[model samples]
Target: MLSLAAESWMLYGIACVVLICRYVSRWLQLGSVSRYQIEDYIMISVFGFYTTLLVTMNIVVHYPTNLIQPKDVPNLTPELVAARIYGSKIVVIVEQTMIMTIWGCKLSLLYFYHKLTFGLVQEWAVKIVAAYTCITWLLMEVLYFLVWCRPFTEYWAVPTDNIQCTAATHHLLTNFIFNVSSDLFIMCIPLPLLIRSKLPFAKKLMLCLLFSLGIFVILCAVLNKYNSFKHYNNAMWTYWYIRETSTAVYTANVPMCWALVRRIFNLRAFNSPDRNGIAKLPETPNIDDVPATIGGGEFRKQTTTPQHIMSAE
Candidate 1:
């Protein structure tokens, strides 16, 4: 548990650093916080829920919980039972915040894709994926709160024999299905556009790699569920929970940090303007209105950043 707490805080710290870099990149690119897009604001809210998740997970670790082996149930005194109940209550908050944090990341990515595909044929795909993501989230919530455990109190009921209430097997399964499927849908949104763009093969691969960071998040989700099922009695799932959320936060924010990377390193390849004083896509002349950066889409008249180009790829 000590190690788990340490790992959680460490991952949270890294996530905070990346988030700061994301916003700084946005500010430098857009020239002001007022010009920040919807995805930027969504990430801020996601981080708020992520912080809550970290605090609640630590509280769960500090207190004993009903999620223990059957052997431990025989020795449960009133004080231990009460502590377990308290921890179980905290588990409810933890689950909610975890869902919020993960789904918030999904929503943030969807918004970014919406802007990325705007004024293009791929915009319709974004809309469809956005609807699917939202619907799955709602279904997962309904299954968790209403279907899985009856009357909502079984989740914290001490001395209960229901594994569904104690171990949350049903919740985990449904969440796995919805979460992974939605992430795949969201990931597919930008790939086709990147492929269709006439950018050089190397740049296309780089952009695809950036958008494909969600693959790590998806892998973490799978490993999280696998460990939870394999070591249900040992609380091994807690570590993966931290890892999955941190990876999601990282994947969602990293693509936006390119501006900061370019600024700090003085990289001229992507940000250099052409002789006509406009951002140039080497061979793609048909889509010059499309923004080049993954996250920033403030293509207003006042903006003169040469990073804006034909396509995100």
Candidate 2:
């Protein structure tokens, strides 16, 4: 029972920290270019939504974190039942927020791809499809939560009242269907480009893994859907939802978060970061550029000193 309360938040906390680190690293590297991008702002909004989810979960009253036995129904007082009913309303909001947060993060990655594949993908149709996918998620899934029921209150009352409600099963299946399908669409976009790069086989494989990390988010969506059937308890289900939310946000941020990890470890191999609009000129160093004549193998760059300046020195 305690695991229900603790585990999701633990994961959410880590995800939140990692998301922050990703942006912090970006801002440190690119200033406003990093801070103000549509993708970066969307991630911040998603993190805000995730934070609201955590707060609402703690503040609202939920059911007995265990299975609701028939005997326990009698023990449920009017106040407890009312609070639980109110919690149901909050859960509906949380569910909507979850869809938004998860898809918002996903859209951010898609937008990243949109920018990434701009000139790289020459065909207009491919870019149109990617844009349409983001718009479809925004219009179809997000609004589906708002209008799924004829009267929205009816949707929340099912937990506490004997109200006839639409089948959530169908909506969930549709939700996960789009979830995984869009995931496939986004993951597939840059593959041909990456595969054709002059980069060696190992580097290409690493890029593939980075882009395809969303598979874990898809896995979480699958597991959460599976758990929905096995654990019908409200509190337990809430934990699963939180896990899904955290994984969504975490996976979305990780493509950028490696920069933070590299910095913290003093790693330089992948030291590349956005250096603003300036193009990095290659260091065309030659043998004459090095002062190898210095004693004890100590070397300094050879500076061209004027003849008069050298004589004065």
Candidate 3:
């Protein structure tokens, strides 16, 4: 119960910080590009939705209990039946958040790709990748829920029959593999192109750093995989509360951290709260609109600075 409370509060606090940063970024017009703006909203939505659900589930799980069990006839104790029900809900929420966050990360990657690349082929690649990512993760979400819904008691307790439940474990493994692969793919996609851009090593390094937040996401996936493998057949309560919360904390924070980095660097386009020295650039064509000659090739505007990008890395 204490663990649940701590996790809930931490997630709530993170959600609040992200929200404040988002509004500040918007007010300052720090986030000027359309793609960046969309990624910001998506990040906020993912964090907000997950945290809210988790807090609510914790409330339900910890609500005042006063049920009389037949076994304890004289001295009645609070029935934990509701805890099981709510516990299952927590697992579902955790799985949902993780799946959604994976999608959010993929979208963020695609948005950066779109902003950085301009040719027709590059544009098509972005669209195709976005479509595939959304579809795959949506299917994974559906699979998770279907597994969660089988023989309701099986969710809150162990099944009497040795028969397997839905393909939840399989789905999770698939999702984990998919996410890690996607993270590596997204991280590598622009490297060769960046190398060809002929930008200074410093500039190229900065761009790579900005996209490197995906590494944290991959790390989170690894942690989740380890936790799941270590606790494959535990009681539902431990399985749902401990393992699920750990995954939620790591997965949900990825995008929030990413957004916070954008906010700190004043990269996203909203007006800064204290405009002491960082002069606000005009909201035209975005920083990515300028085409500079790199390597032997000319690339469009890549406005990200070294410091701003490296912090995220």
Candidate 4:
């Protein structure tokens, strides 16, 4: 029978593969209105790079040993000590990727705000909030690495009983605090603007529904952080693995899916060009389609494009 941990690990991997295909399909569709933005490209690269490192580390560390080592045999040098060292490095990389992916999602939300919100103040506010979020993430990661880099073995092993090492609690809490803050920031940034937008009732409802999807990601982060703090056993290895992989895979995949689904459903808020400055009114009417007079008075019949018609009161 499969254990819960093993099942979660398997499901996590499958989710990653599913999400990767989803992203690639969007790139290939030629019909998805969603062009991969800079944030999207960064997310894909980070996900791919970190996943490659993780798989490589898994093979290097776990492949050489058989299911059992003979009890009579003495210890021998493992396939490569490099795997442990590199695995440690990859753990750090994966963490960075998670942090980057968070910021990327936040920026994508801000970009959505930029595209959807019309006011200059709202645009500048999103930009400033994005900048602050990015800077703080970078600083925290840099500080984390610096703390981890001292003697390095401090990360995975206890070098000396006498040497006091930085508590993992400190790092974990710092990370958790910032991640939750960033998530709340992403969730809150566009609310006021969205509430005040000129979109019709239906479109406004759709926009809220779409934005709420990010809440799923925030929940993932919270659960993953809780597991990270609580896990301390061999069985919990699976917890760590699932948490890392799921947080990476699901968060990355969901936004791409949202964009595609919105495009397909023809959500007027997402599709209407007038909402994004891709439309304008024409000053001149075609002579072939002239005015219609009513009650002996002359009046020009209103001519509106499909986009304009959709942006109704």
Which candidate's TM-score is highest?
1
Task: Arrange candidates by TM-score, descending.
Answer: 1, 2, 3, 4
Clashes of each: 0, 0, 17, 0
Clashing pairs in 1: none
Best by lDDT: 1
In the order shown, what is each candidate's alpha-carbon RMSD? 5.1, 11.9, 8.8, 10.5
Error in Å for residue 212 of model 2: 1.1
Cα displacement (angstroms), candidate 2, residue 220, comes to: 0.7
lDDT of 4 at 116: 36
TM-scores for all predictions: 0.87, 0.73, 0.61, 0.61
lDDT of candidate 4 over 1-313, digit per residue (tens) = 5655455547657767756655654553334427655645655655664455455434333322111224412443453334444444445544555555555556655654444332334456667667777777777776676763455555533222212122345566677777677767766655654455444556557655655666666676677667655752223433444455455455445544543444555543232346556622222221101000110011111322333221110
Each model's lDDT comes to 0.79, 0.58, 0.49, 0.48
lDDT (10s digit) by residue, model 2, range 1-313? 5665577578877986887787776654444553457778888788888888776766543433212355667787777667656666675666667787878887787666554543332235357656766776766655455655545566545233322222355567667777788777777765665555443455457767876777888888888888766665444556767878888887787766654565687653221222353322112211111010110011111222222111100
- Give the poorly placed runs of model 2, Cα more than 4 Å off: 31-35, 59-61, 64-77, 122-126, 138-147, 158-167, 266-313
Can you write out model 3's per-residue Cα lDDT over 102-181, one digit (the tens) per residue?
56646755764664454423556667667767777767666555653455445444212212232255766777776677
lDDT of 4: 0.48
